[model samples]
Target: MTKIHTLSCDIETHSSTDLAKSGVYRYCEAEDFEVLLFGYSVDGREAQVVDLANGEQMPRETLDALNDVRVEKWAFNAAFERICLSRFLGLSTGTYLDPASWRCTMVWSEYLGLPLSLMGVGAVLGLEKQKLSEGKDLIRYFCTPCNPTIANGG
Candidate 1:
């Protein structure tokens, strides 16, 4: 059997722009846009996270896989990952990574009449090690815009 190279990724980002209102492209254009964390697994193995917001560099292997057409990139919402990574890699504004090389699990779930979210899908499938229940709350805390106040460590 031929082995296929796949990199599954999820990223947490912080942006002043409202992603729900503006969409991924506009969200990427925000001045305060930043990729806080990049989590990925190679060939379905255990995942690793790169803490970019804290100044951690992505590993060279992950970098190469992202750019390599031979390596199929998979994510729940693949377009977001591709576009965000394009900006993070300093690609020209409005230009994004090739969508042809990416796959979206959300699309698959929708096609199968399953829930679109990772957590929802896990619950539906009764998968072991389902997504964390507190993930959404944490995402709201770290990935969304917040008032800059002394009490909140602004």
Candidate 2:
């Protein structure tokens, strides 16, 4: 029997002090931007996280797994991951795996005309209750620039 390939991933980002002004783009280009997190799983199990804030890096084994053609790296927005990995590893991402090899959950969701958000899909599938009741508020807080204390600079 053929063994299933593992999925590898990494997430790069910059956190914004203000979500409103920053918007989603802020995560892509924050001044202090860096690869904030890394995730990987084998056949969708044993998911792991590496927090770059703590100076964590992928183990040599994980890096070896990435070079295995049998493994398929997964990501939400793969381009970000690819670019971030390229910069972090000091090697062109092309050397490890073709960009086409990575599977994007976000793209799959959109193909079904479902909400593009990971949280939205989870809710629709009844897999889990929405984690954030005030998603918009939280996104605004963490992602977007903060609205003026008073509207219109009251």
The most accurate candidate by TM-score is 1
lDDT of each: 0.90, 0.62
**C-alpha RMSD by candidate, in order:** 3.0, 5.6
Question: How big is the positional error of residue 98 in model 2, measured in Å on the Cα after superposition?
Answer: 2.6
Q: Write the per-residue lDDT of candidate 2 for residues 44-152, one digit (tens) a residue.
A: 6766888875898777767665556556778876765755565555564244245666778788889999888767887888885554667556544443344576647
Please report the candidate that would top lDDT against the real structure.
1
Worst 10 residues of 1 by lDDT: 1-10
Question: Per-prediction TM-score, please?
Answer: 0.91, 0.64
Name the lDDT value of residue 120 in candidate 2.
83
Error of 2 at 142 (Å): 7.5
lDDT of 1 by residue, 31-119 (tens): 88989999999899999999998899997878888888888999998989999999988888967788889999999999999998889
Instruction: Estimate the lDDT of model 1.
Output: 0.90
Cα lDDT, model 2, residue 46: 69
Candidate 2 structure, TM-score to reference: 0.64
